[model samples]
Target: MDRRSRPKRHEESRENSRRNPTTRTIRREAIRLEDVWVAYAGSGKPAIREINLFFPLGKLVLITGPNGAGKTTLLETCLGLLKPYRGKAFLLGVDTKSRKILEARRKCSYVPQDFMKPPYESYTARQAIELGLVLENTPDKNTRVEWAAKLLGIEDLLDRPLGTLSGGQQQRVYLARALARKPLVMLLDEPFSSLDRETRKTVAEILRNYVDRENTTVIIVSHDTAPIIELADTTIWMNEGKVVKVEAK
Candidate 1:
């Protein structure tokens, strides 16, 4: 082979390596906050202050604190829904403040504290679950909806209108919706608020299984941690908008 041809062949080999699926790298931190602070309008103090936290992939993290302790603020900051007054937040290696964060946000699913709707609102459990996949244009939408409903033990409630269901039932439907997305990172706020003791235990086991099977990151905010405490890899306690302790369990 000619010398010129050898260089060209070497360049082509390098290009092939770059495009190889096996060569891809994974970021270690699924969610990270660096000295972050977030404040509400008309409030002199920040809701979360000088927080530095890291949540790695494929682990269950529990955040627990009293009301007004900024657990909600911390979750929102991680998702880029709340802008930081100082420092930075990153989700899946994408800076939360960056415009490109939308791409990262799409890889996450959130179930907020107030997911229940009024009795007059009319949307079936199946329809609500489908919406999560629909928003992302996920393929095999029907299959995913069915899978989520079954996983959450809500198959019987699928055709029932969400408003007609009890608060606990509605919570399960919303949780199914979040799971249908197959998200890389899950942020759940007060997920077990309305659940009975038995249902809470079931949901906690499901969440643990999800993290193990999918290799995803899960961050949960709850006042009652009994159901999920055993499954947690790390527990973060916050008070007055500051993380008072982070313990590995």
Candidate 2:
């Protein structure tokens, strides 16, 4: 084309660009770790080494392994609760090492491996659940809390002191607390540890439905995977602080 024609073409291209703006690639993963390694204070060796993971959005992922497999460490590292000494970790596209990690974490929920309350703890189940909304400004906070409790069959225990409940009941309360937030991501450690077979099945169903309904990314660390395996979209196996296998449905 002639130089005059080229300028006209360029102008047309710029106009088209302005009309459509810019199109960027959609992020597929909510959590990603690139060759991550973590070590606790005074530890002889790293808890997790050379860990690489990618958890796609709206997927139910299960991390399963025997005790001492660094499952808990992996979960904490993903949330920036434990920073990686080497490599990188990202949550919802924000680097875990960045100062903005906390801001990214606000959109997520975590249920630790130990949720049992001390006997002196006086918070009721409903109060414990409501605490999940403290950082949020939801107009329907009470409705969300009640709905989560009812889903876990813990509405009756709403007024009961958390410390006074049975282990399984407390576990349900904690689960309800995390669910009530409607977080974009959920990291649950040993979610079925204290539940019976029936309760496990029920909780699994509830989680599956929640993920489907909310399009939330859920990463569950469980030594006992039978209850959640069927519903999980991906399963990651770890041993000796390394991912040994990965299975996806």
Candidate 3:
């Protein structure tokens, strides 16, 4: 493979780099799944159990499991939407369970598993994506929105109401919003579950380019593996609420 064309699985593991990076000095741990288990408060069993996973910044990791394996719960925990009953979930090196952790979440973005544009979020695709920048008061809001729209190949739908878009189109717009922050980390759940293989591949290639160059960490949850099997740097297999297998690609 052409060195420049390949993605860096780990910064230190690189054959060469523009600058040397160290484990201790990473900007922040994008994600850490340390003995983490999440259960709805009062529930007996955790949705996922003992997930000891570490994802470095700038790489893409894929999560695979059958339905009810707790894939959505894992993504929710990473986004701080769910608190683990046992173990810890960290975002950008800070424990996300803290009340003050909203700041930590600001550096993260998510395209939820449900993939629906919420009620008030029925804005046009561009409007929804722009809201991400508006909430952050980003300096170049228009430029950022345009970039995300173009990157996702949804520039044509920029003015279309999200409700009118097809499932695939809506998914792309959801991705636009999640990526609007140029976030340090992104959590996407079943992003391609509905798309055909060719379209899925195209989207995957676009995301791969973004993460590889911008050093963004992307953790995607999906039961489908045919498209992303080769692109992921790490793959975690969930079974009955536990990570039964982990393979480094």
**Strongest candidate by TM-score:** 1
Q: At residue 2, what lDDT does model 1 achieve?
A: 89
lDDT of 3 by residue, 34-153 (tens): 899888867776788888878889989899999999999988888788888889987766676866467667777888767765445568988878877755765788888888888888
Instruction: Give lDDT: candidate 1, residue 209.
Output: 96
Worst 10 residues of 3 by lDDT: 16-25
Better of 1 and 2 by lDDT: 2
Error of 1 at 183 (Å): 0.6
Between candidates 1 and 2, the one scoring higher on TM-score is 1
Model 3 gets an lDDT of: 0.81
- Give TM per candidate: 0.89, 0.88, 0.85
**Model 1 over residues 1-249: C-alpha lDDT tens digits?**
588899888888778657742212226778989999999999998999989988889999999999999999999999999999899998888888877687777778999998889998788999988877765765689888899999988999999888999999999998998899998899999999999999999999999999999999999999888889889999999999999999996
Highest lDDT model number: 2
Error of 2 at 170 (Å): 0.6
- For residue 157, model 1's alpha carbon misses the true position, in angstroms, by 1.1
What C-alpha lDDT do the candidate models reach, one value each?
A: 0.89, 0.90, 0.81
Estimate, for each residue in 1-249, the C-alpha lDDT of model 2 and write its tens digit. Answer: 488799888888778756633211125668999999999999989999999889878999999999999999999999999999999998988888877777678878899898888977899999999988998877999999999899999999999998899999999999999998888899999999999999999999888888898889999999998889999999999999999999999
